[model samples]
Target: MISLLKASPAGDAVSALLDCHDRIRSFTALALRLARAHDLAEPEARDAAAAVHRYFSAALPLHARDEEESILPRLRGREPALDAALAVMVREHREHEAAVGRLLAACAAVSARPAELARVAPELEAAALDLERHFDEHLAAEERVLFPALRALLRPEDHQAVLAELRARRT
Candidate 1:
């Protein structure tokens, strides 16, 4: 089991983003598991729901901003192919935000009343599945295409700027 609370390395913005992706996947999976676990005890259910909620509600938006504000803008117009990939990344970010809202709502419901998991399970499952599907593809694209392109195209100064922005946002 990946420790959801593990900190990503500092200084390397790209590696931090990759670590964030891993956390995203882990939390999404936890949401799915909690949704399906009809017999889970209330305390365990509540803890799991809260964990998922905290990650999506707080960390995710910051990660998106790191890409949109610091990383993507720097990479734009460097290559036509990269430009197209960046567009797709933006579109997918919007989609993920919408899906995350739905998932968070379900998580909030469960967190408020862990005993209500049975009632909220359907919505939670649907939202988690939607996000999982979208994110699986989205993370792949960034890891395979965008990150490599970012490494190739961005200047050392650009990376420093990104690192600063990433750190500043967290602080």
Candidate 2:
């Protein structure tokens, strides 16, 4: 599926975050596809499960931290109106984290034994759909409200600091 938003230039923290969002959407789609693919071969099942597992297990938490630790903290108090939105963002992150844990467990089961895919298909589908629904709202909120705020309220120096923090977390 095409990304909801256009790609931004490299080296911008917000752009990096947007890229991560695209990835989250892509893997979520893959999870849903894998769950529904009843006739998939063993090798394909294992590969798909591993790909989904790796992205959610590792990359997702880092993206969340990028928002929660690096971005949200700076945006706080800049606008009294944004405080409520920021709180919602944090709450949703927690919710997504919990949901991802369940999804990852399902992915792990399929990865360990491809035959297990049939047993776990319902769970995997439910979790993937749940995540898709939640991310649709959460990512929209950030793109609509938070990202514009980040660009408007923060100084160039602040953007550099945030970018540095994001890069440091990866390394």
Candidate 3:
């Protein structure tokens, strides 16, 4: 289904992905705020950390899996050059999962003491950068190659049907 905001029945999945990007960007900003805060154990800090952790643990992994398995594979058939990018992107996804694990552990260990968040901050920064880079590159690849290829390969009805199936699975 299209968003109320949209006049057309464009792929809602793309908008959902963009929404995820916005959330991740906000969460990264919040992480920086927590890093600077004196009380890392504050409720706000913990809540933000949990939100970020939950996104990475649940939505992020599932989205990446869907993209890699459904979208990327389908796109790969049309563009042979995507093979290298898809392979590297898959590896980066694994790294992202590992990094999320470390970041969540850091949040769980947060206390009034300096040592708690200090350990997590560095790991979080690296992971956040990695995620940002992966996201940028993947989106760029899709915009430049995948989506354009799919534009020709799949009909409008096909696009709508695939999106409907995806949203069904998502819900």
Better of 1 and 2 by lDDT: 2
Kindly indicate the candidate among 2 and 3 with the higher TM-score. 2
The 0-to-1 C-alpha lDDT of every candidate, in the order given, reads: 0.85, 0.86, 0.59
Query: Which candidate gets the maximum TM-score versus the true structure?
Result: 2
- Model 2 over residues 98-165: C-alpha lDDT tens digits? 77988999999999999999999999999999999999999999999988888888787787788777
Error of 3 at 142 (Å): 3.7
> Which segments of model 2 are wrong by more than 4 Å?
1-10
- Clash pairs of candidate 3? none
Model 1's number of clashes is 0
In angstroms, how far off is 171's CA in candidate 3? 3.2
Q: Which stretches of candidate 1 lie over 4 Å from their true place?
A: 1-11
Query: What is the total number of backbone clashes in candidate 2?
Result: 0
Better TM-score candidate (1, 2) = 2
Tens-digit per-residue lDDT, 73-150, candidate 3: 566655567676667667767766765676566655553333556666766667666556666776666556555556
Residue pairs in steric clash, candidate 2? none
- Residue 59: error of model 3 in Å? 0.8
Residue 43 Cα positional deviation in candidate 1, in Å, after optimal superposition: 1.1
